[model samples]
Target: MIHHKTKVAVIGLGQWGRNHARIYAGMPNVHLAAVVDVNSADLRGFAHRYKAEAFTDYRKLLGQVDAVSVVVPTNLHFEVASAFLETESHVLVEKPMTATTAEAATLVELARRKNRVLLVGHVERFKPAVRRLAELARKPIFIQARRVRPYDRTRTMDVGVVMDLMIHDIDIVLSLVRGRIVEVGGLAVRVHNSQEDLAGCVAWLLASRVSADKAAEIEVTTPDRVIRLDYLKQRLAIHPFHGEVEDMAIHGDEPLLAELRHFINCVNGEEQPLVSGEDGLQALEVAHRLLQRMSTVAPPVRV
Candidate 1:
């Protein structure tokens, strides 16, 4: 078997998964072997567009592909991704990795035991501005992140806003800090859905050069600088000894296209995932702690 032309299958061809199908099919090193979804309607265009087989049941495609991209809902993440790993296939699961820390651990251990690659699609890490910021990070002191959506009701029902949105920031922060978490304090409330729609958290680094007094703010301070990322605006600003704000705007582009290509690299032994399964698990761990500390203050049940 030629290792370079790795065949791949995509489970769950919904809004997000469809994009994965497109990129994997188009990329040079990958062969988009198949797409599996419970809904045939969703699989129709995907099969035609990607020149890949479509299946209502993923089990049929199990041994046919070398790798699988599990882009299913958070609830199904554990079941779907674990199935692929059991067959010794590499997995690239979309973020929040799994519904619980235990499930994430399961996938991670399975991948390790099978000697297969397990990557997390924390696509935010692939964003150009975020990529640039990561390149310059040096033991960040404090951090702040804000991710607001206009009530999709797509994922919030399954998990809290902390998982749907904030988890991305959590992943980035954890990857950058690479430090010990001293304390965690948070607040969350259900603005519209039964699950919390809004959440904000503060994590303090135990030993750092940034001023401890500035702990109240979301600023990621370091010994020499204070950087703030405005993901919404695709802008990043850096504070240094000489100046206060050095704003940078990411050029027009899409990052997932880049991320898809990177996955191919991992399969070919060219590179490693920017965010591995363990990295994704850490973010979820932090989120679970936050949700635990501050009970879900949902708007009354509408029976």
Candidate 2:
């Protein structure tokens, strides 16, 4: 058991936030203090089901918990986390840390000053295959990643695919390369709405180099040694460097619960945070670079 107990609250009861509450509520060392959501039905249902307090005002929940997870929209991340941190509560936040780099920096600094554990919710990093691959990653000369969706018209109302989906692969790539991006190029198309649904980006990073990812965006990721991920027919594809590619149809599960377990471990001071604010900021920086470049046809080269 962890040395000290921790009280936690999950703010926002959206689809993603509900998962956060589920995981935290089950952890033995943590207390799922409360869940705050504007929707009365969702708030009541989740609170009763999880045996956590229900409230519409996060501020009210703030005084009642030691740590909180912010699962609201990307735009509200900075505002909500800041409020909780200012009150001396540790925070675990969902990705795209904040809408702006400055806001992300502010939260990072605020958490540091207060000696609070500030963790970002980058769920894919916790995948078993990724954890094993990262251990074996070496200098890779090239990299390519693809993240496609059937079409969730309402999912990305505030951000594009770069932020909404590709950002996951982007963060994974950046983490492995650990390089300074020399230049970035992108191609995106909005398959369903005003925002770009399909995005492809290439980063020329001055990286230390590592082995490439075997599976990206529904593809099975392979490492130098061992057969890690299982790919079903079209669900994921596993490649053999020496043999023909193998295809399988299977669904890869989301690792949200494992991620929250890791966050609680970080808060318990048993291990360092898996996704730090700096990591989130780095991913956001790359995401913004792609979108900014995509916005202009070719901003007449600066003389």
Best by TM-score: 1
Report the number of the highest-lDDT candidate. 1
Put down candidate 2 lDDT per residue, 104-191, tens digits, no spaces: 9999999999888898888878776666446544554455554443543355367766777677777887877789988887765544
The TM-score that candidate 1 achieves is 0.88
lDDT agreement of model 1 with the native: 0.76
Displacement of the residue 175 alpha carbon in candidate 2, Å: 0.9
Candidate 1 residue-wise lDDT, 73-97, digit = tens = 8999999899889988889999889
| lDDT by candidate, in order shown | 0.76, 0.72
Provide the clash count, candidate 1. Answer: 2
Q: How many residue pairs clash (N, CA or C atoms closer than 3 angstroms) in each of the candidate models, in the order given?
A: 2, 12
Candidate 1: deviation at residue 16, Å? 0.2
lDDT of 2 at 85: 89
